[model samples]
Target: MIAAGLGCRKGTSAETLLSALAAACAEANISRESVSVLATGEIKRHEPGMIELAERLHLPLHILDEAALKQVETRTRTVSKHSLAQTATPSLSEAAALAAAGEASELIVARLIADGATCALARSKDHS
Candidate 1:
């Protein structure tokens, strides 16, 4: 399974998110169609843009709590000061991708920066 973890500022728009996803997908050398799920922090569950993007893509959205993100934060590559201060994680996108993809997941792409958003991709070793 492949997952795309997303982190965005408040009031981010779905178009901006789609652009970010495209950049991240490009970085990972995979089409957006390859992504199986969308993941984000639980705190962002209420973000309308995030919700809209997921719905638009017809993919499952997995919201991970702080504890869940923390469990895999250490495995992430990029260290965003904002992410650490706001979410206590080195990288929300990276951690979210790893955590939601499954315990045995590995990051396929590190943080891909975009306007008011960030994304990372992960693949499950067991394909579960």
Candidate 2:
């Protein structure tokens, strides 16, 4: 499965999230429809923009807890001090994507930051 993981500031707009997702997917050379799921840190499970984005995409939104997030932190290529301070993870987008992609997943796209939001992509180990 290919998953897109997102991280955003509180109250981020849906348009911003969409744009970020678009840019990230473009960088990874994948269509948004190819994304099997949208993933994020558990703390963002209730974020309005994220909820809206998932609904708009008609995809499941997977929420990864802190432990799940931490497990993949070292695999993330990008580090944001602000994100670390806010989410207690160096790379929420990468971590969430890797976690949702399941064991041995690898990042297909590192974190891509846009206005108020960040996005990354990962693929399951079993996927080619």
Evaluate all candidate structures by whole-model CA lDDT and list the values in order.
0.92, 0.92
lDDT of 2 by residue, 1-128 (tens): 99899999999987899998899999999888888999999889889999998888899999999999988898999999987997889999999999999988999999999998999999998976
- Quote model 2's TM-score: 0.96
Collision pairs in model 2: none
**Which pairs clash in model 1?**
none
- 12-127 in candidate 1: lDDT tens per residue? 99888888889989987898999999999987899999999999999888999999999998799999999988899999999999998999999999999899999999999997
The candidate 1 region of ten consecutive residues with least summed lDDT is: 119-128
TM-score of 1: 0.96
